[model samples]
Target: MTLRNQVLIWIAFFIVLMLALWIFRGILLPFVVGATLAYLLNPLVNQLQKWRFSRGWATAVVLLSVVAIILGLFFMLVPLAGQQVGGLIQRLPGYASDLQELARRWAPELNAWLGPEQAARLEATISDLLGRIVGFAGGITGEILASGWGVITTIGIVVFTPVVAFYILLDWEGMVRGVNNLLPVQYKDEIRGILAEIDSSMAGVIRGQGSVILILAVFYATALSLAGLNFGLAIGLIGGLFSFVPYVGFAIGFLLSMGVAIVQFWPNWWMVAVIFAIYMVGQFLEGNILYPKLVGSSININPVWLMFALLAFSLLFGFVGLLLAVPLAAIGGVLVRYGVRKYKASALYLGENGDKGGDQTAV
Candidate 1:
């Protein structure tokens, strides 16, 4: 095909692909989860294959290993986590009371500024919010489970994700080669370069950042549990997971843990201080040591831009968009850089009549 025809065909194909994705967006969740699962497990499968195992067997081994680890966690931590969740829900009224009392401590100052009537209304509003927040999570979950179909869909997605992952992992190489072979000859190299960039960015987030998250989770969880904090494991895990978002996770975890501490251990300032110090040290280690050694410059994304992408995508496509935000942002960053480079070297940039070569050579 001619170069112009090839370019046009590629554009048409892209349009079709995007339209198809939109049409089937609602049903894409399980497949998306399965594809992500395969992507995560494929590395382990490849490693075992290199040691002389067949692809099928290697996939089986990896899947089995993953299941074993999950089962172990279930047995070891799930009960405690569940108990903690129940306890927190049950204690919501008490938390509300504590928060209200704490707010009232400052009501006198507010009364001086805004007068007693407004200050009293402000306290009432704060109390109402606290009470509502206690049921906010349960309300959402109840809504999701309100219909029988919702429960069935949830169960189906959980049950079938592994099955889809196993098949994809076994045939991963064939799938890659098939897609590569179908790429237009003119754009294949360019497309391959972009794919490689996406792979590099995903590796930092999925593997390197994943390791950092796990380390932080264990450190914080264990430390908090030792400190006798209520729901320490859950709080620590939440903090570590949030670490995936740079500074936001640590801050959330610290504030949450401290809030619980205030409710559970009020007038005991030492424990709250300890919790604060733990998160501060964790942030310091991540900034100075872990990130540079592991993730380094692999993902060329701005943290603020990433948060915006997450918010926008999640709003547009719900959970799928949220799950995809980071990857899409990374890919978007690559395309932007590509566009800027092309623009800088184009005739329009140097001026239509300017000497394209002489201007470049002078620099």
Candidate 2:
């Protein structure tokens, strides 16, 4: 095929693939999750292979060990998480009452500053918020129900994901080789270079981000739990997990910790400041220590763009979309860099008149 036709054919193939994915997205959850796992475990599998293990043995060892670890954590923490969630649920009513009482205590000052109408409105808003907090206690369960995932879905993830992952892992090398074999010989080197760049980028992001989040989670959870916040561990875990998307995780964790601290340590009140300080310390450690040491990337992406990718993917593909978004965004970034390099060399950009726009970025 001519080069233009080949390009068109590739574009058409991807379009069809995307359309198929969109159409059957509901059923793709397990496969997506499985593929993500395969990608993550591929490094370990490759390392084991280097140690002279067959691909099968490497995959089996990695998958079995990983599953065991996951199961262990689930069994170990589920009870604790359930206990914490239960306690929080039970105390939510009292927390709501305390908030109302606190609001009433400030009513005099609020009224003086804002006038009766606005003060009353403020009180109503407070009540509404507390009501939602009460609703949130309920919403936690409600949201689960609203998600439409049930026992079967859980089983699907637990069962089929490993099976799919195993096949992918088993054939991972063949898959890569197969794709390379299909590439046009003329562009194979260029494409292989791009794939190498992508693999390097992915490794840095995945392994580094995973370690960073785990470290932050441990730090935040331990600190908050020791500080005696009622739901600190849960809050910290959430914060740490969300940290993958920049400051989002920390902000969320901080807000929850603050709310819980206010509810649990009210009247005394200094505990709230203590909780805030814990988050500040966590943020400091993350910014100054963890990210610098772990995620020292040569090509730094804009946080704004990262946030945009997260939101855009979440909007388009829900949770699974969110899972795919970051890597896709990273890959997109790499592609954009390549496109820019090409554009810089092209007459359209350099101009037929050759305006000499200086050197192009080689990101």
Candidate 3:
């Protein structure tokens, strides 16, 4: 077969593979999570093997340790999270009253510019907004309770994921070698190079970004707690975790924290000021220290492109799209860089003298 025909066939195969992944995403989630966990832990398992331990033993040790840590965390966090969630629910009515009072006190002055009817209309609008917010909160609470089955299924998946990861880690090297051996000899070196590049890029981005998110979470939680905010721990934890998607953590944390502060201390500008100050300090630390130290220069996706990709993916595939967006963007960035380099080197783009825009070369 001609090189052109081979290229077409390879492209067609990849398109089909991507379609399959998209269609079977629900079934694939556990395997994908397991594979990612294996990738992250493989280095540690390899190090244990170097200490004269057999590969199987090392894999078993790592998997068991990981499982123990996860279970310990679940035990410690679940009760605390449940308590905080319940407390928030209990406080909702008080919060609603505080919000209503603040609005009633402030609305008349702003309404003075307009007639009483306009003011009443403005108050109605505000009431409608508050009602929607309450409805959303109630909806979320109902969903959580309704999702008892989902919670059980999720726990099962989490338990099974690490177990699957252990076997995958153990066989990772052999799997790579087997796939390489199956490739045509003529293209083996090129394929190996591509795979190695992709693997390195994925590993660096995943590990680095994950560490950054954890660090930011700690920073946010500590700062908020120190500022003596209600539900600080919960807000900080959620904010920090969601920070993986660029500024999402900051946006969510800011709005939630500000709302809580306003509700807790009605008409007290000072409390809102304190919350804002805490968030500002946390943001400064994240921008100056945490992200720099953790992610470094690993992911080169620009903010604009990252947001666009995230929105597009989320629209197309919901939560799964959101989860996969950054990794896909990182991979696309790498491929785009390679394409640019190749384009610059090509005779079609570069002149015979290798000077861009000089005399064009005939193909």
What's the lDDT for all of these models?
A: 0.78, 0.80, 0.76
In angstroms, the error of model 2 at 331 is: 1.6
Ranking by TM-score: 2, 1, 3
lDDT, ranked from best to worst: 2, 1, 3
Quote the lDDT for 178 in model 1: 99
* Candidate 1 lDDT by residue in tens digits, 82-175: 6876676577667778877877777889999989999999888867666666676466335434422376666767677788888899899999
| Pairs of colliding residues, candidate 1 | none
Worst 10 residues of 1 by lDDT: 140-149
1 against 2, candidate with superior TM-score: 2
Summing lDDT over every window of 10 consecutive residues in candidate 3, give the lowest-scoring window: 140-149
Query: Model 1 misses residue 349 by how many Å?
Result: 1.9
| Cα lDDT of model 2 by residue, 82-102, tens digit | 687677668777877877888
Which digits, one per residue and each the tens of the lDDT, describe model 3 over residues 219-262? 77777778778887777887898787778788867766887888
Model 3: per-residue Cα lDDT at residue 239: 84
Q: How close is candidate 3 to the true structure, as a TM-score?
A: 0.80
